[model samples]
Target: MLDFLNDILWGKVLIALLITIGIGFTVASRFVQFRYFGRMFRILGASQAFKHDKHGHLSSFQALLLSVAGRVGGGNIAGVAVAITLGGPGAIFWMWVVGMMGMATSFLECTLAQTYKQAEPDGTYRGGPAHYISRGLGARWNWLAGLYSVLLLVTFGFCFTALQSYAVATSVGDAFGVPVLYSGIALAVIVGMIIFGGVKRIAKVTEVLVPVMAVGYLLVAFVVLGMNLERIPDVITLIVKSAFGLEPMVGGGIGAAILMGVKRGLFSNEAGLGSAPNVAAVAYVPHPANQGIVQAFSVFIDTLVICSATAFIILLSSVYEPGSGVSVEGVALTQSALADHVGDWGRSFVSIALLLFGFSTVLYNYYLGENSLNFFSTDNTRLLNGFRVLIIALVCWGATTDLSTVFGFADVTMGLLALVNLIALLFLFKPGLRIMRDFDRQIAEGIEQPVFDVSRFDDMNLDAAAWEIEPEDLARIRQREAAAVAQGK
Candidate 1:
């Protein structure tokens, strides 16, 4: 049954769905991502007051960490390998396009998640596709929420969880000669210790690990690119050719390449997957949109930055043959590609990084499933404990199973849940538009600096006579709007 389902899951069914949604979102947003491309990173990095609702649990920065943890997980390693293997070099180009467009979709989805977020009995908060879907589309369609929860558990809880374990074990065993079983056991124990502390702890760990892993990994890629710098121009040309249906022969021209790149890129970044929204809810802020923008930056970090690093290393190595040499699979292929040019020891560096990447993902994924389960029931202690146990057990199952099915299963689940999420966004687009305008207006009117501050919101008079925001935020928004009206940005 798993095998049969896995086939349909990864085959055209999910692929078609992903492509359609990516294209649909890009069109609906009027290609706003391109217009906002310059400001996206700049706005996210600007110093602003974060709205921290008195009831909020996590900080805006913490929410980004959680979302980053989920996105930067197993997919960054094995998912990329799978894309290259099946889609050929052209696929990388498509992935980049997807990442670019997906950024807009991510901004929309996360904005809605924040709009519908809930305070919890435990002082923390919970929200995601499930919450926003039901809230936006109306309670009549709550079943969609239930369906999305099940898919999330299967995809995030089992498939990716196990994939992470497997990646870490496989990479560790290859690099350190550690036994796979030992690695798995250690992974389980370490994961339990971290998750026991819950969302805040998970966020803390990811904040530290993500940057180190990302920067460290990028530095290595830069070194390789420097060595093969001469081929940089040719590699870029090839990427463009494959992207535009211009592939020499055995491959499809630029069009197929573009699609392939988008496919893998979306899989890697998961902008519309509705996964990041779960983490975005935990932030300590009054205006939920603060976390939305922060989470949007995560898509940029995962796909635009880290995934780009992997692509550069692989292509720059001039070692990524259509039919490869070592039959390298998963993280091993990635490590081997790095080692080929950098030296044998480079594998160890990647192996360690993969371990942090995978382990952090498991902790954050637990939060995704946990939030869903919370939505399903309130005082069911048994159910909550059962969820934790089930997630852990699935982690073990994923570690030992044949990964082909796991990958397929995850793809299917991700697509299915995202289907319901997309529908929810359609209904909620009105509120989302209103809130974004309000946010931008807040900046334009000089109401507040773009920062998180819950106390400021407690008694806020929306109808205040004078605009109270910081001068800079409002000035920038007006400037951008004026630019848009002038140059049609």
Candidate 2:
């Protein structure tokens, strides 16, 4: 029954829905993801020094790191191996395609998350699909919000945590002969210490760890690619031809290639899955679209940069056999490919990388669930505490056991959550577009910094306090605009 449901939800329904929504948002936003690519970096660079916000919001860079922590995980390593094994080299091409389209989807949902965000009692910001669904769509749609929250809680909080833990434990056990039980207990303890510190600690830890892990991984990949520079063209050609079933090596045909690519691509980057926006909304930005654009760049980094690294490593190696009937799945396959290229130490490197990737992912997933739990009952400390304990338990359980069943169940839940989020995104896309336009207009008019004016959204169902501009800052912005206007004249 679980397999059947997963096949229906993820295999059939979601593949089309994810593609269509991605394309729709891309077109609707006039390819904002592409147009603002340079600005994305500018915003990120400008946000490096964390700003102190009285509302307890994270700086934009911290938020970007948080989302990237979730995006670049075991999926980038193990998931890429699985895609190549099943779908052939052509799967990598499809992954790139979905990632490009998913960037736009990410932009839309994250912008909505920022637009409808609200303040929490603890002086932090809270928003996501649920917050936007209830706040943007009005009270009548609160049920949809609740549904999204519940699905998010189940998918990320429980299932994904287990899956991440399992990946780490399995990899470490395979590499070092460590017992899964010990790894599970250690993972649980480490995760508990960070999560218990709350969102601020998670943000701070990821801000440091994400950069180190991602850059280190990419640096190693560059070395490998440099070693195989002559085969780069052949690898690229193989990927493209395999993607369209033009290559005979892609035994499963075009259909399997598309499925594997889209599934793992979405899983790796999480562009349209509605998970990233929960963190995206926690950033303090001059405009809602600022964070959205930052997140769009994250999709690029995850799929095009990190995931491509994994693909290249495998494709450039002799260990990858496209037609072999032997099963080489997940992290083990990745480790084998690296080991083939660089020796036994390569396997140990992969295991260590997986530990960092999985641990950070566990933290991000926990925060997503905690945020959703807050939506149900903000005052229910007892319930929130209970959920945290449950999350820790699930982490340990996942480490000690096989999670094939857990993964299947998570796929179904995640598909439903994505469906709900995509629907909300479609409904609220225009408002997000308006926000983008407003931000663009400011940039075009030579404003170095764009600020959002809540007055522009007076007719909409937004929390005024969320977008309130301080008088002093508002005065400074007006003075700059005035100077720019005079200079134009």
Score candidate 2 by TM-score against the native.
0.95
| Candidate 2 structure quality by residue, lDDT tens digits, 383-456 | 87888899889988999887888888887888788778878877887888898899989988878678888888
In order, what lDDT does every prediction score? 0.68, 0.87
Q: Give lDDT for model 2.
A: 0.87
For residues 278-337, write the lDDT of model 1, one tens digit per residue.
Answer: 777555544555555666678888887788777777666645764343366557677778
Alpha-carbon shift of residue 139 in model 2 (angstroms)? 1.3
lDDT score of residue 138 within candidate 2: 91
Q: Which stretches of candidate 2 lie over 4 Å from their true place?
A: 48-50, 325-327, 471-489
Q: Provide the clash count, candidate 2.
A: 1
What's the true lDDT of residue 434 in model 2?
90
Question: Against the hidden reference, what TM-scores do the models get?
Answer: 0.84, 0.95
Q: Choose the strongest candidate by lDDT.
A: 2
Clashing pairs in 2: 90-243
